[model samples]
Target: MEVMKVLHMNGGRGVTGMGDSSYANYSLVQQKVITMTKPITENAITQLYYSTLPKNLVIADLGCSSGPNTLFVVSELIKVVDQLRRKSGHDQSPEYQVFLNDLPGNDFNTIFKSLPSFQKKMRNQLGAGAGPCFFTGVPGSFYGRLFPSKTLHFVHSSYSLQWLSKVPEMVESNKGNIYMAQTSPPSVLRAYHAQFQADFSMFLECRAEELVLGGRMVLTFLGRRSEDPSSKECCYIWELLAIVLNEMVSKGLIEEEKMDFFNIPHYTPSPSEVKSEVQKE
Candidate 1:
């Protein structure tokens, strides 16, 4: 499958409140990741403001999925920068040009519909002193360039980098599995790692070209505690899903060939692996 064409979180609000499979309803885990990384995000923004203090701040949230969490991030960033301006006794806060980027298939309309209320809340909280904020949605993959050269001042992404641009081509022999697994051959593991390195390097290169000097980026994504590609921490959930799919195949509920052809375009790299790629870039 072409992941870029087909992969996206379930869009729109689901049946009942926050109980169904829609991304808006079922993204608690991603929200938690945003909360967990709050400190890092705040710190980066603080430093960026103190260092550059651009009169017009351009911030992009890459891989920003639909729902409250998307706007939550935008709100938090503005709050931090606004608070910093007040603390510094600056007479004028920087104007904000916020960009929300995700796959073209994302539910951008859902996010846009909430902007009026979000702007009203910001006005109530920050009053007339808050800088004017403009929002635009950029639809594309972050694995390639998505903005003009040296345009962004701050960039943030959480729980996104783990998604590969595509499934590694050499893993076709990885039958009975949809991801890296304990039973996967050494060659399969190598192929996955190579794909990650290439994709991540390109990601860094594109971001480097886009961010202005001294700009900051805080990225948080899934990673394993060990270098082992099939470590349980990274692969156990997929392994369980594979087990269920195998059972269905046994019962003739689904074709084995179909299962064999499927593989998730995701990879949870170890810290060292990520560090190496970053350094290379």
Candidate 2:
């Protein structure tokens, strides 16, 4: 499948708010991930504020998928900045320009609809001390440029970036598998790693041009603990998915040819692999 063209969260809320596949209903783990990484995120924001102290603070949340979590990041940032400004005896709170970004296919309307309530909550929480917060959505893949040069002060992405821009080329021979698997040949592992290196490098390079001096970025995504691409820690979930898919194929629910052509455009790189790419960029 062409991931960029076809892939998106099942947009909108679930019917009856129950057993449906909408991202809004199914993003608890993502929310927890955000909560888990809050310390790192807060520290980055704190450092950025201390270093630059821009009166007009600009923040971008790349892959800001629609749901309750959509504005959670913005709220957290506002709180951090507000406390900092108060402690520093700055009478004026920094005006905030928040850019919530995601793929074009994301259900941004849901996020838009929630803005009134979000603003109301902010008002109640911060009262008269809050600065104006303006939000706009930018739709595009972050693997390429999404903002103007030196326009962003802080960049954040959570539970995203594991998705590659596209499925790696030269994996057509990875039959009976939807991702790198223990049974796959060494070439398949190399292909996935190579794709991550290229994609992540481009992501860093683009962000470098967009961020202001001393800007901060915090990215949280799925990754492997082990160096092996096919290790169970990283590939086990995909392996289980492949099993279900093969079962469907056996029952004639999906065409074998289609299954053969399908491979998920996702990779969970190890820390060393990520460090290598960062150094290269």
lDDT by candidate, in order shown: 0.89, 0.89
Lowest lDDT sum, 10 consecutive residues, model 1, at 12-21
Residue-level lDDT tens digits of model 1 in 1-281: 77787777777753222335778888889999899989989999999999998899999999998887888887998999998999899989899999999988988877887788888899999877889999999999999999999999999998889999999988358899999999988888998999999999999999999999999999999999998999898899999999999999999999999998788899999889998998898
RMSD of each: 1.8, 1.8
lDDT of 2 by residue, 165-216 (tens): 9988874488999899999878888999889999999999999999999999
Off by over 4 Å in 2: 14-19
State the TM-score for model 2: 0.96
Candidate 1 RMSD to the correct structure: 1.8
